[model samples]
Every structure is written in structure tokens, then in C-alpha cells.
Target: MIVSNPKQKITAVIPIRRGSQRVKDKNLRPFGDTCLMELKIRTLMQVPEIDEIIVNTNSEDAIRIVNECYAVGGVKTYRREEYYASSECSGSEFFRNLGEVTDTDVFMYCPCTSPFVKPETISQCIRAYAERGENDCVSTVSQIKEFLWLDGKPLNYDPSNAPNSQDLPDMVALNFGVTVIGRQDLINNRNIIGKNPRFVVTSDIEAIDIDTPLDFYIAEQIYRKTVIEKLELLE
Candidate 1:
């Protein structure tokens, strides 16, 4: 049971570009009954704490779908510039441009790539951010207790002396499924992860990020096996 605070002006941003290199218009591709972009918008709408949901995209198909389905529920579609839509555009560039669009107390960067990111998880993250008096930002992350390596070097453990998986230091992988940051932080830092950022640890299923075709397939399977099956049982 999450309580909504009316005074907190929270805006959710979902960026979908027209072109996709790996998945080929993955945002508009059919997932279950609705497309990915629509699914994300629908999920965001369920969270009462979010005052506004903004979909920044240059895709006409995305705009049409939003107009047809989600135009009523505090969902606004912004016509993204061609420059920002390019694959060459950096994440910082997007955030910097996004600041000019809406003025809210908090900005939530919600990617449509993670289809399994539930409304409840989002609500909880928003609640955590609002309650965090001193913290500047809150981003969703997945806890990894397994061995980690980078450049053939053990990142989380020593090569010669390895500890048990449970005893090892729990590493957090940033999912980027949901990132909440203040307007000032976005303007100043030009990044989602602020100086004093709090982490919202999420389940592995909830952290499914779809980049390639294989990733999309795996995420879809996980969503069906975990989320949809759970929902069916509840009914």
C-alpha cells in the first residue's frame, strides 16, 4: 500500500527513437497484445505518485499509438528532434534536452526496454525518492552476488583466493529501468545518477533490459513466466 503525495511533482520520461540498430524498431514491436512503448506508458499510468508521463520520440507510429490509447491519463508525447533521435546522441544529451521540455520537482527516466518493471516497483522507487530528504537521486539496480570480471581481471574477488558466493560482496548492477533525479541535478550533473544517490534494489526479472533480439526474446519469456503467470494466479 503506497500513499501518494500531491505536493511532489514527479514526471516520468520514456524515450523511444524511430530507429533501432539491434532490435529493429523494438519500441514499436508487438509485445503481448500492446507494443513496448504503450506497455510502458500503461505501467507508468498505474502509479498515482507520477504526476505526468512524457514520451519523447520521433516515431510517428509511437505518437499515433499514444494518441489512440494513452492520451487521457496525464501522458504527453513530445516530438523529439532528429539530432537527439540518432544513435550517436549521448544519454547526457538527451537529459539536457529533456530539461527544456517539462519543469517538475523530480524527473524519472523510465526506459521501455525493461518490460517487466512493474507499476508497484516504480511506485516504491518514487516513494523512496520523495522520502529521501538528503538524497539527490534514486536509481533501480539488480543485486549480483556472483563472481564479476572485467578485462580478464577479477572485479569482485581475488583470482587466487575466492570467497563463497554468499559471503562475497554484493555488487549492484544499474538496470536503468527507473531512475529518479531532481531537475537541478539534471541541469547541473547532466546525468541521472546524482552525487548523493540512493539505490533501489530490484529483482532480476524486473531488471530485464532488451537490447538485441535474443535479449528481447528472453525478456518476453521471463515476463510470461513470472509476471503474467503471477497475475493469473492472483485472479
Candidate 2:
């Protein structure tokens, strides 16, 4: 069947929370010369397809950091309510409110935790959404190795597990590092994945989301190994 791509406008939502369960003031935590939140804001602002970069945050410090770092004038702010501020608050609620305020054909959601997003990744997801006419899309990754799962019962290990990692069957997993949702679907369904969802493939590095102090430290190490070394060469 001949296929036609859907073309739609895109907006970005970067959500930040004041209360961090793992690390204290994690968003404000330093990453080289800038804070973690600032790094994400700056990175998202660089994407040309992003029509608007909205910061859905409850922290005034986070708001101030974005104002100071990002040059994107279309940046909008959403003050998360107390009920919605808790960790219990579903991400869909944030999108629901965002959908109500903004006017865009497609919606993109990024968490403050993942700071090393590339402009190309954003563009690719945007292209996928527009071309495929999918209701929603999220950054995903594939694992080629089998894993052992131990529930409350006995071990659930594969009997014929291969010694080599590359020999195992690949498993594709959603990264939630960069999620894109169609405007109407996000609004009506109040979900990132509405009726139809697409998976936008991305690298493991791009999918690394900081959930704990150790995760943050690992990100820092990766950044130093990859980014800092390059900056040094530019000099």
C-alpha cells in the first residue's frame, strides 16, 4: 500500500519536580559549568523542530535556571500543583495540563533527569511522528542478551543461556528518555501512548536516565569520557 506521511507542528515539555526521592536537589546538581536542569534546557532549546519549550516545574530555582540559560523565547512555564507535585502524580497529568495550554499538532515530553539528548534524536522522533501518523512515540532501545529474573519463587533462569552476550535474542525496551505524543491523543486520552504508539530507536547512552546518585555519577563519568575530551580538543 502506498503511504503518505502526516505533517504536524511540535512542542516540547520538560518536566521538573522539586522533591527528589534519591538525591537532594538533584536537578540543581552540577554538571561541569552548568546545572543538570540547565544542561537539559540548553540541549532541548537547540532542536529547531521544537516550536515551544515548556518547563513544567514546581521549583523556582529550576525556573530561574531555565530563564538564565536558555535563549529560546518561546519557553513557557507551568507551575505544578501540590497534588500533582508528588511522585505519585502520573506523567500523563502533566501532559494533560500542557495540552490544555499549548497549541501544537504534536507534543514531546522530556524529563530533567536525562541531560545528554541530541538535537538529531529529537528531529528523528518528530519526523517519525509526522511521517507515520502515529498517535504517540517514545525513545526505545534493544538488548541482545537474555537476563535472569528471580521472583519470590525459585530462579527463572534460561537453561540454554549462551556464554556470549551477542548470541542471545534481542529485546527492545522503551527508554522514556524522549517521549512524543500526538496533541489530540495526549489531551483526550491523557496518556503518552494513546491509541497507536511508535517506537523511535535510540542509543543506550541517549536512553540513560538518572534515577539514583549512582546513576547520576555514571552519567557524569560518561560525559567526561565523551564530551569533555572533545571540548579539550576544540581548544
Candidate 3:
């Protein structure tokens, strides 16, 4: 049962698969006390600008858990096919399917691995896309100053220059936490990034994603230390 919000027109699509090569049961694994997907749902639910959220997965346990504990009126689940559950399955395919079902003007692609993604960032991406008017896709990015290389060779070609990180022109990389895409571009191009892609720069703190056991541990610690304190104050 997906809740319909007439105020906002954006739809959020979260594609979660059962197969995880690095960490077993990654989506269902507990972060603090709640499962990863549950926390992701909680985060999405808090955003006023998100009209609806759909979970695309095939795992029986995941469906059961989400249905029992996380099935809100605005959140719906889609059963993915075995073919789409493969390790080679492209996320773009899921996004395409979701686009067909919702027909939303703005499609937000959020990953369940990033539990700490704030609603503010989600709203920010939405506003950025709408205001830009010409953007086909918008994604969060972090500026990096570290030495980069390709094929065992330096990329910047200046080994001697150790300029202050702040002084150097920022190089941005997709953070993959939150992506806002226009429906028309995705349909026309079959990709997130169309001809005009917007990059929203974000802080490193909002970019922590859980991929391995170590990553989970670090996220858990960070949540307990910082988010917990903030929540306690709200209480």
C-alpha cells in the first residue's frame, strides 16, 4: 500500500538485491538495532518532499520484513524477477521499471546501504533539479584533493606540486547516496546522466556508505556517537 501525497510529485525508488559479495545479508543486517533497509525506509519517510517510495527487491525475507514492520501507506514493494536479481543486473533496469509504474516527473534513486543520508540532502537534490530546469540528472558529489592515477600513471601530471587542498580546483566524484533524475531524460537516454547533468557537492560526513563489515562498524559507531546525541536532544 503506497501512500499518495498530492503535495509533492517526486517518487523514490530503492533497488535492493539479495546478493552481496563482500558482506553477507547486507540489506537485512542490523545497524544498531534495526535492519539496513528499515533505517533507509525510516529516513525516506521523514522527507516531506517525497511523495512515495517503492522498494524493488526479490528476497522473500526482505519482503516479509519490510511488509511486517516497514509497510507504510506511502511505501510500496515491487517483486523483482530472478533475472534482475543476478549480480550483473544493472540498477538502470530497476529505475526504468519504476519509472513506468509511477510516471513521476522527478525520480529519486536512493541506495539502502546509505542509512545516514539526511532528508535535507534529499530535499536539496529535489530543489536543485527543479530550479536548474535544464538538468536531466542530479547527484551528490564530494570534492577530492588526493593524488589520482589511471593505469599506474599520475593523472594531474604534477608530482612536484603539493598545493594546499583548498587552493586546488576541486575534482568531483559521484557519491551514489542520493540521485535525482528527470523522467524524460531517463526514458530518452536510458541512463541517470543525460546530456545535462548537475553535480551537487556534499560533505564527506554525509558520504559514508556500508559495504563491508568494517564499514558497518564505522557507520554504527558514527551513528551512536553523533546521531544518537542529536536524537536525545530532540527527545
Candidate 4:
């Protein structure tokens, strides 16, 4: 049976799908003796700030796995329609209706792609959001420290007068590691981040998002070295 914590107020909705053409079973694929799907639940379960977790996916395997092992951890699966997870689905209407899946006033859209998001980041952001009233949303971002280009133009640096990489102004991209937004704002605007958003800065390592075969390989190695091996040392 599913569980809900009325006092916490904020719900965590994780949207993942069965069809992964790039990495193939990306979420369920093995990593450090566990998969991304398992690790994500394990990570969120550790955070006291997140009381309820709804895994919104169209995968039967995913639903069964969560219900069997993770339901007790306040994790449950929402049976998303197959069409909505398809490529033909309309981005605007489909995303807007996602907020309707649950009635929480506020929710955190947790992406399963980002595997290394720290519990401290999520907990701190939630506390910050609760304290700040002026900001409408709290979302994670990673600063673009690399030299960027748009067409032929230098986006953040000059070619000939090359300045030190550290000297460049802050340019950030949505890392989608931790995103908290109002339910009404998502339904009304058909957006994740609102007009006024509070950005939570994450490190490049934490911002590793898996979308391709190469990404899976890279993240798997990193997780093993930085996480699994370290844990083994203690044992």
C-alpha cells in the first residue's frame, strides 16, 4: 500500500519511462551492484525533508521492483499512460497535466537521470524554500565553466584575448538534479521552473546526467570509484 505524510507538505515526483533508446534500460541498468532506479529511491529515502515519493513511470518492471522492495521506504509507483511517455506526446499539455497526478500544493520534480545529487543539496534547498517567500521556485543548476560557443560567436570568452577560465562570469545551465516548484505554477504555466526561481548550485560531478551509452559508462565508473569503493573500505 502507498503512504503519504500530511505534515511535510512537499511531495517528490520522479518521472522515468520504460523506453530508453539511447542507453537501453538506463534506469534499470546495473551500476555498483544496483541500478539508477534503486539508487535514486535510496538517496531520496535518506532525506527527512521528502516525506512522500511517487515514481511516475510506464514501466511494469519498475513498478514491481519499487513496490516489492521500496514501498516501505515511502516509495510508490504511479502508472503513467504509455502514450504520455512516447515521443508523439505533446510536451505542453502532457507536462501541464503531470501536476494533477497528486494534490500537493508544492512538489519537487526529481529526475532519475541525475544520480549523484547530494542529500544535503535537496534538504538545504527545501529548508531555504520554506524560509524564503519571495522566490517562487527552487531549482538546481551547474555553472558552465567550460568555454562555450554559439554558431561562430564566443558565448563566454574571447579567442585571441583568452582570459583565465576562472575569471569568466557565471553562466549556468539547469542540471535537473533537484527542482522544487508549486503545483499551481506547473499546471497554470506548463513549466517546471517558474518566473521567479531560486537556483541551487551543484558541482559538475553531482550534475552528471545519463542520456547516452557513453554517459552510462562514464557515470558507472565514477560512481564505483567515488562511492562504492569508498564504502567497501569501511566494511
Candidate 5:
């Protein structure tokens, strides 16, 4: 078994909730052949660098699924407070809450939303994060070189003197496909990405995080592309 350093254990912390305003039971809803929760847990299990996997959730169904299929192979479920899982909460304490739950040396915030985040990508991120320690957090992001607009203004370029999109400064957006940080750093910062965060660039398809109904539908189509067109994995 490929393991983390004995001094610093890496645990995958997956937080899921049943009450998704955008899409009901998103974590447990039928996806491709398996649901998001099951798919994510399975994906994490493939990463040998991850020492442990914890499915933190407020849904009984999510807990049941984990206990049934994912309970083995260092994967288990942790019941979190329902209030913390609700939409009303500010979510500022998410990392701090995770810090309070477990004492693992390192925490990988692997959300189930990004179902397409490849296992190899996750393993690579974990390997890179092993060297970061408490100094830096490693996260997956997609480089956006396209023209961006904000509050009636060009965010990344001047419209009059626009350069080719390729020539524009690459703006990295946090897709949250995966985030690795030390427990202490998570507690100290109250966020997964601390002050000194290193980014691992992921492909556009792998960076898809299913949030809205349209996002869920699009992800399903992207996923089904495998069976429909016989495309290569995540191609």
C-alpha cells in the first residue's frame, strides 16, 4: 500500500449534505452507474497516497451508502451537524469544523461535486502536497485565459486594446476538485486554501463542479459521453 509519511497522515475529508437547494439529493442522486457520493468515495479509494477517507454528511442515506459499500478500505462515514450542512450557514467555518472533527496531520478537502476529477489527478495532487507540509496548501484549479467581465467592466483586459486570449494573463479559478492542507493550517485560516497556496492545473472537463441543475445535466452528458461515443477516459 502506498502510504503517506508516518509523521503526517493524509485523510480525505468529504463533506456532503442531503439538502441541496439547486439539486435535491445531489450527493446520492443516480449518476452514470453510481451516485456522486459513491463515485467520489470509490475514486478516493483508488488513491494509495490517501491514508484514510471520511465521508462527512448529514444525510442518513449518504451514511448508509458509505457504510454499505465504502466502509471498507480505510473509508468510513462521519455524521456532521445538520446546521453546518444547511444553506443558511455562512460556510466560513467549514475548514475549521473539519479541523475540529479529526486530528489527521493533513486534510484533503475532496468535495463530491466534482465527479469528473480523475483519480490520477488526485494522486498527483496528494504526492505534490506531501512536500508542502504546513507551509502551503495545494489545490486543483483551471487556468482561464478568456476575456472576463465584472460589474460593467473588463476584469482581465481592456476591450479597446484587447490582446489575444492566449496572450492574456492566466487567471486561475478554484474548481475545488481537490484541496490539501495541514489540519493546523485549516484551523488557523478557517479556509482550505491558506495564504501560501500552490495550484495544480487541471483539464477543463475534470474541473467541472456540479452545482446548479444545468451543471448536473451537463456533467451527466459529459459522463455519458464515455458510453455513448466510446471516448477515452475524460477525453
Candidate 6:
């Protein structure tokens, strides 16, 4: 169980740029009834612990959508600078600027590509961050027990001595679905992952990140099959 602290001010940041090389207009593309960006905004609004939801995007379309539909609550849009909007720009460079954009105690970095990320997961991450005073950052990860290799070499296991799949060490891969970091850490470290970071393991469904056309199709199917159907049944 997670408890919310009213005193802690947390801001949710979603950075959506118009230039997508793989999937054209991926953020603005329709997921179900609404686009991916709108769905993320709506989902973020459900998390009560989040004090404000900031949509940092270079697209004018995104700004218009937020102003027209999601500006009612704690949601606000910020026009991203041209330099920060490019694909060649480093995350640290943009995040450094983000520290200047908002004045919240903590920043919840939520990517719009992760449409399946639940509000419960977001709340849990925030609560874990709050409870763990020693940790400067909390990030969502997917636990994998399967064989992993890099550069044609076994990474998680020894080739000479093979062990049972269950006996293999559980590896946690950063999902980047939800990350909680303090403003001071962002400015100091120039990265979301702080020195002392806590990992929150999430399910495979919740870890689904849409980056390509196939990914988008698969996520749409999952949403319609799982989330939308459940909501319809309740109604």
C-alpha cells in the first residue's frame, strides 16, 4: 500500500517532439479514440499525487490539444526550444533546461511512448521515492530472467557452465516508463538517474514502449483487449 503526502510537490513531464524518424507523427497518432499524447495526459491527470502535469513539446498541435482539452486541471504546456527539440541533442542538455522550466520539488519523467503505464505504477514510484529518503531517484524496470547477450557474448550467464533458467540471476532492465527524480539531482547530475536510485519492477504489459509501427499496433491491441474492454464492462 502507498500513501500520498500533500506536502510533496511533484510535477509530471512529458517531452513530445514533432520529429519522429521511425513512426511519423507518432505522438499525435490515434491510439484508441484519442492520440497517444492525449491518452498520456488523461492518465497522468488520474494520479492525484502529481501536483502538475507539464507537456514539453515542440509541436504546435500538441500545445493546442492540451490548451483545448487538458488545461482545465493541473495540466500545462510549454513550448520546447528548437535546440532541445532535435534528435541529435543529448538528454542531459534538455533535462538541464527542464530544471529551469519548472519549480517543483520532484519531477516525474513520463514518456508519451509508454501508453500502457498505469497511474497506480506512477503513484507507487512517487510513494516509494517519498518513503525512501536516502534514494535520490526512483525508476521503473522490467525483471528479465531470460538469457541476455551483448556483442555476441553471453552477458547474464556463463557459456561454459549453464544453469537452469529459474536459477539464473534476475536482471532488471530500465523501462523508462516512469522515473522520479528531485529537482536538485536533475540540475546536479544532469540526468534523471541519480547516484542513489531505487528500482520499481513492473509487469511486461506495463513496460511496453511504443517506438515503431509494430510496437504501436501491438500496444493498440493490448489497450483495446485489456483496458478499453474492462472500462466498457464497468460502464
Tens-digit lDDT track for model 2 on 93-174?
8667767766777778788787776878877777776666534554444343555456643233445653455654556666
Which candidate ranks first by TM-score, i.e. highest? 6
What alpha-carbon RMSD in Å does predicted model 2 have with respect to the real structure? 3.7
Q: Relative to the true structure, how large is the alpha-carbon lDDT of every model?
A: 0.84, 0.71, 0.76, 0.83, 0.84, 0.87
**In every candidate, how many clashes are there?**
0, 0, 2, 0, 0, 0
lDDT of 1 by residue, 7-63 (tens): 657889998989788999899887766678888988888887788888988999888
TM accuracy, model 1? 0.90
Of candidate 4, the 10-residue stretch with the lowest lDDT total is 1-10
Name every residue pair that clashes in candidate 5: none
Cα lDDT tens digits, model 4, 1-235, are 1113245467888888896788898998788789998888888888887768989999999999999999877788899987878888887666686887766877888887899998888887787677657887888998977888899899898899998999887989998898887788888878787888898889889888988899899999999999989999999
Ten-residue region with minimum lDDT total, candidate 5? 225-234
**lDDT at position 171, candidate 1:** 81
Better of 3 and 5 by lDDT: 5
Best by lDDT: 6
Which residue pairs show collisions in model 4? Answer: none
Clashing pairs in 3: 3-73, 3-74
Tens digits of per-residue lDDT for model 3 on 1-235? Answer: 1123234368788878886678788888766767778888888898888877888888888888778876755678888777777766676775565566555777888888877788888888877877766666789887887777799877754668766656665788877889888676676666666677898887777887778889988888887788777888999
Q: Which of the two, 2 or 3, has more TM-score?
A: 3
- The Cα RMSD in angstroms, rounded to one decimal, for candidate 1 relative to the true structure is 2.5
Q: Write the per-residue lDDT of candidate 6 for residues 1-235, one digit (tens) a residue.
A: 2334556678999989986779889899888777889899988989988888999989999999889888877589889888888867898988888877877888889988998889999999988988877888999999888988988999889979989888899888898999999888888888888898999998899999988999999999888988788989999
